[model samples]
Target: MNTLYRKSLPGTKLDYFDTRAAIEDLQPGSYAKLPYTSRVLAEQLVRRCDPETLTDSLKQLIEFKRELDFPWYPARVVCHDILGQTALVDLAGLRDAIAEQGGDPSKVNPVVPTQLIVDHSLAVEAAGFDPDAFEKNRAIEDRRNDDRFHFIEWCKTAFDNVDVIPAGNGIMHQINLEKMSPVIQARDGVAYPDTCVGTDSHTPHVDALGVVAIGVGGLEAETVMLGLPSMMRLPDIIGVKLIGKRQPGITATDIVLAITEFLRNQKVVSAYLEFFGEGAKNLTIGDRATISNMTPEFGASAGMFYIDEQTIDYLKLTGREPEQVALVEQYAKLTGLWADDLENVEYERVLEFDLSTVVRNMAGPSNPHRRLPTSALNERGIAGDDMLAAAKAEEADGLMPDGAVIIAAITSCTNTSNPRNVVAAGLIAKKANELGLGRKPWVKTSFAPGSKVAKLYLEEAGLLSEMEQLGFGIVGYACTTCNGMSGALDPVIQQEIIDRDL
Candidate 1:
């Protein structure tokens, strides 16, 4: 351990590595300009890396040098069933190979904490049109996954340092955001920033809490579980300066979709982004999470926000213990990871975006980054007034349009974690219901939020039934429309399509 920089954390008994002291000693005044990413990484290096190579690794961040490989030991590893199962199965294969060579197969166990959540692959066989969709869907999931689930159960007992969360719990990313990340971690009487790696790209969702989290491939996650440090050169640490406030009634989803397109155009492929400025300050942690969760869409490794009052507020709101929350704030401020501490930080590339300039936006028919204004269908000659008139008239006359909206889904996991979007949706649904609007017979509709808490609040607000009245019922979790799994089309619609060949 590099005890040279170890110091007492004033408010807590746990000791912390003084990253600022070490950095300033190396290069005077350089510590003040380190970005949030650098500060967290440098802390890890100071606390965990071999003392012999610590100075060189610290130089990788202090000088913005990307030539040499430094080691990154993420504090935790998270996974979803799809990739989690695959990684575990690979371990089993390795164990077999090791046993063949007369190696101790039992000794080959994960050293780092691993949490596997079975969520992503849950197929929505039962559409939300049915009142009992959640139960029916889970029943189908259990029956079909009977064998795979048996293995998952076995994995729970067989694997060391691994926790298996069965299906129907919630989305892995959401669970991580509200529960898994601590923002600050304490080990062996030493406190440092929490860092994590998840097999899924949306892993950055927890970055809203100021944790240094990155998404890795399945193999990378497996390697991490085996306690292998991620070998890395520094990525382009880009800064996104958010300015202006979001217009009234503009949801975080709207802002994120716009930001996703903007970041994609900036060619920030594999960059680590830090969002800050007045606009970012105005955003709630929920808003930051929405943007960070879409890291994959922007083709970035992470979308980070610094620890600030917002991060503290979110921690408390999500039910984190008071002591832990205090530790996060104190640690962040002390180690220069706090938002206020980053005013002088510099980035290789900086992008400026205006929150007010963005219109309420949505993505394309295929891509999340292919942003479009909600009103663009007419301008783009895709859906004109004539088409709308014809569709309404046809519906009234009991005739089906050749092209129809077959699937309607609230699939991006709002209402569970994001109250603003879901509340707006529920209000809209209530208005539509009051207007006697109903789901089209040909459409299979579903509402899948990441957490069940969404149901409680929506019910309390009398919006759940309002949405359900329009066929936007609580179907199940993990019904993401972006993933090509928004439940099956109605059987009648399928038959009609087959018969008409349209």
Candidate 2:
């Protein structure tokens, strides 16, 4: 509590708060058994907590006692356009209220670094089949949300410590994973873990890089933005031991869907999960990110992986500076936050999952946690009994029949952030084109990847043209369908559903 230990990085002028020193001081040799989350939380408290109360707070984390509350000051905040805009609007209102109270309105501003990406406002009105779908959809978005865009543009200049990524750039989560987050941040001669709270639940996507990011509501995020600690008790930490390798041709989506079903059945709601073991070690950062992005769907507060080689590789692949990447590795290894160092870390409860048990699958009509194997679609009453007859009837009637897919989109950060998943989709499209198969006329299909880099890889693989030939052309980079922005259905199709009470 009194002058927590600090040490300089070897061969560098920067320094970091020695979390291990603080832990050992509280209880000798206690740092070795602390979980990765606890260690990071402890460092933050030691650096930010009041000197008088710091010892008690460190005790709560060290002893794993949840009876008392502790304060957590996240390093940053991330958001999408919808909630970020609303939060700023509220702040604007607060400024006015301060003026009415004879206070300086201009003094109100965000206390932490805030990044807002304009991703949730666009819709997929122009289907991939259209020749100018991307341009048409973007035009429609601008026409419809001109006033909103104006306000957002104003917010960039009006706000302090806020950065805006304009529309048509990419989804917030993907951008954060690929560009924004520095695994180890150095500021004011001090290095610390990069932790944040975002407006969207999938913010945990960056947890794959070993950064502690959690999704919070606008109000809670506003509290953090105003430089207030998020009071909390230690959560029930559960260790998920992933064993065995996934079968060939299996995607991260399949594995996550299976894990979601298993975890939900195990009553893992509101728990913090740390995934480790051989299976986790084999997974690429992209694969881990796909699983982390689905954290909220599995009803868990966080799904974390310890910092390791994969984390360093991803940082390099994403074009991070060499010095920063080195800092991440050095800091993690020195503080025992690396994956190899966590083998002896203890947890209150543990769950084991086998990756080989997962298969090709998709989630159902409503729940993301419900798993449905592709081979059992007919047996499960999802596929129609007579496909040929239905097609023939629709052809004769000169109209698309009921049960025709109105939207088939690949838009969310969940699968798009993983190159393997995106590449597989491209490969499937190529094979389908070669086999003389095309999308159904009534199906409005689009491929809105979360990052521009995805498009680069797909093109380099010589699969983009194949995908486009099959009516899976690139749409806007912003999120579609997942946020209820799937755009308008054809009037005839809308009428048909209405008439049939579907």
Candidate 3:
């Protein structure tokens, strides 16, 4: 530890590295211009890097120089089963090599904290309409992946600094957001901001809580697991100023879909975007997470918001201990990390967005960034007007429409993690139920929230059954449709596939 910058944090017993003072010591008033991402990165360098190279490395950030690569020591590595399994299998191979070379195989272990979540492999074999879908699907998962599960469990016991949340828990990203990230991590009587590299691209989901979590490839995850510095250049830290409130009836999904289109068009590929202004402040943590979860869809590395009261509020809401929560707030304010402290942060480029301009939207016809208005999804747009008229006429004669929707899945961690979005969906279902309108007989639908707690909340709100009434019952709390694990299609649709030989 560099004692020159090490100082006792007030209101807590833990010591924290004074990143602001160190940055200012070299360039007065420059710390104030550093974006949130830069501040977090600088803190880690001050706390972890060699004193000899500290000044030169920080100067790289201070001057926006990308000529040479710096080092990033992420605090943790997070992984879902697919990529995590591949990385662990490699480690197992290395252990064998070590034993053959007369080295202690048991000594080989991850140097940094690592988490592996067994979430992605589950397929929804049991229909959501069945009340026992979750249990049944989980049983099927265990039966099919019996050998795979055995290995994952053995690795958890065999490896040091490794923790695993087994299958049927929840999506890895959601678990990270809800409970894993401390916001401010304390170790060895020292406190610092939490940062992580995940094996899945959507790891930025937890960036909603103001942590600098980003996704990396399988090899990068393994490197971080070994406590090696992830070599890097400073990303194009772009500032996004959200200026207006969301219009009435507009959902977080709508806002994200619009922003995804805008950011993609702005060519913010691989940039670190720091969202600020009144509009960002107004959003709840869940809503911010909804946007952050879709970071890759915008071709961005991370979507970050400054730590503020909203972050603290979310910690409390998610059942974080009060003392730790207070520590997070105090540390952020003292370290210039609070949203209020970053009024004058500078960015290489700034993008302007107005939330009120967004309408109810969805991605369609092709890619996730391909934004399409829901209003335009009707007959006059996708299908020809004359054909739609004929289809409607045919439907009136007690026949199925020519282009009826077969699947209406309410899925993805991107939207379902946001309470506001789910509540709005539930409310719509309630109203539709009251109106005596039900799901079409041929429509196969499911609702898969990223968190298991979603069921409790929806039941308390009396909306689960209403959703079930509309054929949108709870499926397994895992990434299904989005991960290509959507199991068997409806039987009717399957038979149609067979008869289509006509």
Candidate 4:
């Protein structure tokens, strides 16, 4: 409240609150021992807390105490269509109630910046085998969601500080990673870290860029949207030290699936995990994002990485301005938010994971955390069965056979947001085409990247045609299969499941 420590950024007109100075003033030299999370939280308190209560709140974080509650006001709020629409509907209803009580209905609006993306309504109604699948699926989405679209359109004009990205654009998480977050924000002459709370569980995907992003339910998001602080006790901050490099032929997806299993087994529920060490530093921002995107699957509140060179490279790759990128690097180093500065920081619990131990894996059967090593598929009796003869017989009898794959989609921001994963799928499709291999008759294969930029890169690499030829063409660019919007199965396949109780 005594104007908490302000300093002008070097070579810029912008100024930022010196969170470290304030902390050091309270308890000399304490800033050096604070973890990255604690430092970020401390900045918000210094900027927003009341004068009388500020010391008490900062003490809780500084002493690593979890016995008391504190308040967090995120910098922004993001939403996908499903929950975003519902929250807007609630706001509209609240306005009606206020008007009935003789208050101004027109005065109701969001207090913070809210970005609503229409990504959840589209389903993959048409399979990728159809050349017009993208167009057809988008048409179906508009037809079915006409009323919702109308409401969303109204909210665009009726609200303040709101931005809407229409359907068929991209998934919210991926967009946030590519463009929405600045990593370092300069507003009203002050620079601060970019932090947000989104309506979807995968919102932490952008945390890879060193932003403090977390997913909240609609009600909780509403509270934040109305400018109320999200009260919380200090979370268990777990340090996951990644040692050794990943073995060759291993994708980020493989490592994340393995990490998901490990973290779930360790019972990391409701904790904030900081991934660091040699292996973590070696990973690309795309790889870190893949892991952060699965925070919900691993039962962690946030999967954070320290702001470092990888963060700088990603901002440039995503086409951020040079000045902004320079500002991010300068600000991080000056404030001890950089990874190198966190080397001696201590955590309540530390877990070491050897990355070289990871192998190609898939999570399934029922849970995302149930990792199954691809090498052990035959050993575990999940493959190598003699179903070929039975499948041939069923096909000859004009039935969609047993063990048929109803959907084989490369959907979701989970994998598609990472270029390496998308390129890997494209390469596989290309190799399959060269070998004259094709998808089975009953399998519905589709490639739905989280952003159009993926298409640009794939085409530049000349892998788009091969993917399309293999029945993995682009579909609508929204969350398709992951949101239970996989669309209708073929009539025969549907009947078979119905008749057999599958």
Candidate 5:
């Protein structure tokens, strides 16, 4: 019997089952209609469920039943430096606690493979225009993070089933999307899909590959890391239909900023956003990656695009060996995971976003959903001769300006996944330098690519020198400014702002 059963406390109704039999025994051809996420859940349930009550539990998803609790076993855990460091710290504390009791401290280790990438620690202390900006900024990072780094290094040898990808490597999400996650994982004589829970809110960036990656809070990741199942009900799956081609020069960042605003307005929080239609099909995996990477910024749990030729193309482009790529293609096709296979897939709710309508945009001040059009900068009071004059006057007086651009950085997996944005920033920097439009002296700028590949491409394009000329040098490959580790401001500038409250 390929069934599993469990009994919970009174009033609790979580009976777990494996999906293998559910797919075969439920309505014929129903498994193909399930989302990739559901398929993964099914695989885990079948493998781990006890033999007594499998079908009863499988009937819940297969029949759209919603009243039961199911166990989901993610294949692994991925984490960024800030949260990952904190997580390990907690575990160390737990280890001490466990040792105090009769429990063995060494016995407390991650049950599944866990990868902790050291990113999110550097901050831009120098503008991109400085010739020694990269070296200077790195020095500051090492000094500031000595405490965190010491603890992290200890974690390397102290924990079992945990791997540390050292800092100055790249952003965690980009590294995972590019090099870490094998679309399919083979272990212990069994082959299964690769699904994971990451500490940051943007862990879903790798979802572009049809993986069921979701970002969870550090607290939640701790639970999963300790071998507890993430219990939750079925999410509202929302289909976002994209249409029309983007206008020339429109970056994926621009589109995602706009889409993020639109989708949030449409209320997609905690929903699974499935990008479909012609616009999605036309998008390169890089562009798709840019969108999926912002899944958290848009308040969705996962932003998934169907696996298709583009997905295959990206695996090859990123230099994955042929055999692995072949396995991905073969498995996806055989398992009905291809884009064409999901054409008839149904969703409870759907919305539309037009790629053609998107324009160059930036998000922030305080929120990722706050999309700001560059054209509206003057009208929106973020740009204007008056503000510029005030800023210049403050500079003349040796005072920091109101609304000064304190940090202008190129960081985060959201924007870093696309080479276009990186190249664009470099090109703009080059043009600005040629035009004598240097960054305000108060602005701290840095460039931290998520992978070494970006450096190669930028150098090949001859834009690295231009970036350095503007003081946007590589500040060690890491998440840097995006994770709130924007390095210290110039002491003088910081004092001026503090003294004057500017």
Candidate 6:
């Protein structure tokens, strides 16, 4: 049943084979157990395999055959500022190399459409306790990233098929979810599914919409942009069965923190996770997005929830035009991609989690998946009796001390995408202000939301000022304080940590 296919791509002769049949042929009863992701990859191989050696190649995925190699052509490339800047710097250097070798510098361009947004550069130098922390922090951002931004501007006009969204706009993944990706793309009177590889590990945030977005290293993104296929064997797909509903007052961030811990404990690294069950259907696109945005945190490749009503609803709510939204519904339903149609889908493995068990939580001193439940912080030593007393003593002396929560940053697309989490932080800030509580000076608080629209909603709710009062200001909407570019700590605080090695 192996079939051979040929395609004439620019600068390359492409071939595809019947990977499922190839695998089945190599070993009996193999394809049926393949994960949903593998099934899609097998189809990709079948469509792209060459007539000369198709069968031998497809045996890799189907029969657990890992001998031969296959090339996967993702449809697009996405990037954020940190890695994207470094990537473009590399490309610019590569252009230098090509020019040295007499290759046209102009000819070296991204073959696929590449979207690079300015994120990951801002740091919360001022806490929400400041009346204008956002503006102050933004000023600091401009000072720190002057070099990065200058080069990025050069990249815009110098490269073809590349679009840059400048700094202070929003985080990359949120922008993609909101405006960048059109679920079905139309060009030359033909329509195709939108699939992409991003430079950040959290690119799968858009996977909730069924776009097949994945996070790859900058090297992989560059390869894809150059029209080179990312070669790989299909990944293991794991099904996560969700049950029960989250309790009231629990944010999606809390739920995802718990799920991250559970899935990590289950050892679901590098696997494609497909969440199912009634509970998943009840969760809004926002909630699903929060979980999907944390794919890398759980050590998974892609966290996908099948395209369902929530997907369509979110598309409409985000102001997508009627026709495009209709197209998403039509294409998904017709292509057997609709959620209801996937009931019989099989997976290599399955794990179950209950939503009700999730409590208020925050992740990490370092890692995103290290869930620290608020209730157990004392037991865990993050909020011990001694630590509380130390903080109090520091406050009484009009100084910041141990366990200062140095950065209560409301940043990153991970938590900011969910209105509940964003609003919850604002509510907390508002309550703190009313009660005369304020963020410690050492705590550089910031509210770096991932979208301009987020500001609109927060303003509409009248919570923006409350956040600012606590020194949590609108700090140039970007991935600030996350990704370890926390900017320079306070001079005295830096000396203190250095002195104590704490």
The 10-residue segment with the lowest total lDDT in model 2: 1-10
Give the CA lDDT, 0 to 100, for residue 472 in model 5.
81
Q: Which stretches of candidate 4 lie over 4 Å from their true place?
A: 98-104, 388-399, 500-502
The superposed Cα distance between candidate 2 and the true structure at residue 266, in angstroms, equals 1.2
Clash totals for all candidate models: 0, 0, 0, 0, 15, 18
lDDT of each: 0.86, 0.89, 0.89, 0.89, 0.79, 0.78
Against the true structure, whose lDDT is highest?
A: 4
On residues 1-502, what C-alpha lDDT tens digit does candidate 6 reach at each position?
1234322222222222334445566577766565556555665556555646656666666665557678777777999887777777887888899999998888878888889998877776665556666688778888988888899999999999889999878889999999888876654333446778998888999987877789888888888988888987667778999999999998888889999999989998898899989989998888999999989988999998888899899999899998778877775565456787677767668899999998988777678678888998788887787988887886697665754566666787887888888888889889999999976556666677889988888899999888888777776677877766556677987777677565
> Which residue pairs clash in candidate 2?
none
Candidate 4 local lDDT, 55-133, one digit each (tens): 8889988889887788898889999999999999999999999999999998899887899999999889898888999
Q: What is the lDDT of residue 2 in candidate 4?
A: 37
Deviation from native of the Cα of residue 213 in model 6, angstroms: 2.4
What local lDDT score does residue 111 receive in model 5, on the 0 to 100 scale?
Answer: 78
Encode model 5's per-residue lDDT on 16-71: one tens digit a residue. 23344457766777876776566666667676655465566666666666787777
Candidate 5 CA-lDDT value: 0.79
Off by over 4 Å in 1: 96-106, 393-397, 414-416, 499-501
Full candidate order by lDDT, most accurate first: 4, 3, 2, 1, 5, 6
Q: lDDT of model 4 at residue 303? A: 95
TM-score of each: 0.96, 0.96, 0.96, 0.96, 0.89, 0.86
For residue 76, model 3's alpha carbon misses the true position, in angstroms, by 0.9
Per-residue lDDT of model 1, residues 391-426, tens digit only: 889678876676787887886642256777888889
